[model samples]
Target: MAKLIKNSFSADLVRQAKFFKALSHPARLSILQYLAETKTCITGDIADELPLSRTTVNQHLKELKEVGLIVGTVEGVKTNYCLNTQAIKDFKSSAISFLEDLNIDTINCKK
Candidate 1:
């Protein structure tokens, strides 16, 4: 286990690593896709939309919510979930900046 030293190189790297880690799973990606398409959905609707069992879908949704990718509102027996638009935009901007910072265009590969 790597120790995360606050305000250090490894910690900063790990922080950036988590942005991709959050979307690394197919189930989580599916949940995001569904939420993006549907605008908003109840827990039951998500269960019905995916092939996974309800329990599995619920678990995946919980993870998505924890990562700030989704927001959930409990309404009595139902839970309404929607994508956190600001979070999504931040992720997009951060990813774009990270890639641009790599400056891959300068690579020379002439054979």
Candidate 2:
């Protein structure tokens, strides 16, 4: 067994990593795009919009939900899903800061 080193990073970095991981999948991206386009809580089958199966879509939704990107509420037999605005805002801020930090005027290469 190896020791976990994830705790060594800052909380913000960890959170940003989680957000990036959740968005890394195309299915998850599509889900977010679909929700954003709908602009309302979706109680219907979200998988209908994607090429993947219901089970696969649900898994992607779980990842997004776990990362605080999406909220899923149990409404009777259906789950109402929507984007978590605050989390998205926070993610945007953190991601911009992180990306801006890497924005340099030039990069030096050594042979």
Candidate 3:
């Protein structure tokens, strides 16, 4: 596996990459969609709603939480997870800004 040279890129690039990577898996995407649809859900609730096992769902949840896409709160023996609205907003803005800065219209490469 190729190692990432963190010093070679801007911090924003790294951060954006992490955000995209967090959304890379289908399970992760599904988990996010489910969480968004239902304001908050417990681990068991998520497992029940999706086809994945509870263990697999938990792993996906861990990845989402790592990137601040979701937040989890422990209530007794269960963990309640919900979408992180501000983080989602920030990621959207970052993606939009990146695309806007691309200046694709000005590029004249022959297709």
Candidate 4:
């Protein structure tokens, strides 16, 4: 197997990649939107809010949690989930900065 070279990239780029990967899935985006709209920690079944199965939703939640975009606390039989505002803010800043740096309007590629 080829040696892993992810370490070659800057830390900010790696973190932004992780954030983008976590947001790539519609299920995960929906979960984030739901949490943001609710503005409160949810202890109930988040799966019910989406068309995906409970297991699938759980997987998406795990991805979000791994990216530090969501916070999950074990509450006995259930896990309470909430958005990590600080991380969200960081993601927003990074995404905006990265996109702004692209300056797409000035790209003169043939249409």
The candidate with the higher lDDT, 3 or 4, is 4
Give candidate 4 regions above 4 Å deviation: 1-7
The most accurate candidate by lDDT is: 4
Query: How would the candidate models be sorted by TM-score, starting from the highest?
Result: 4, 2, 3, 1
In model 4, how large is the Cα lDDT of residue 24? 98
Query: Best to worst by lDDT, what's the order?
Result: 4, 2, 3, 1
The reply for model 1, stretches above 4 Å from the true place, is 1-7, 10-13, 41-43, 109-111
lDDT of every predicted structure (CA atoms): 0.80, 0.89, 0.86, 0.92
For model 2, where is the 10-residue window of minimal lDDT?
A: 1-10
- Per model, state how many residue pairs clash: 0, 0, 0, 0
Error of 2 at 54 (Å): 0.5
- What lDDT, from 0 to 1, does candidate 2 have? 0.89
TM-score of each: 0.80, 0.88, 0.86, 0.90
Instruction: Give per-residue CA lDDT, model 2, range 22-71, as digits (tens).
Output: 99988889999999999998997898888999999999999999999999
Give per-residue CA lDDT, model 4, range 1-111, as digits (tens): 223457776777878899999999988999999999998999978998889999999999999999999999999998999999999998999899999988899889997
Clashing pairs in 3: none
Instruction: Supply the global lDDT for candidate 4.
Output: 0.92
**Candidate 3's residue-wise lDDT over 1-111, tens digit each?**
234556877778889999999999999999888887877554545788899988898898899999999989888787878889999999999999988988899999988
What is the per-residue lDDT of model 1 for residues 7-110, given as tens digits with 9 covering 90 to 100?
55565457567768878889899989988887755454588888999999888888878778888988778888888999899888878877888898999988
Worst 10 residues of 4 by lDDT: 1-10
On TM-score, the stronger of 1 and 4 is 4
Q: How does candidate 1 fare on TM-score?
A: 0.80
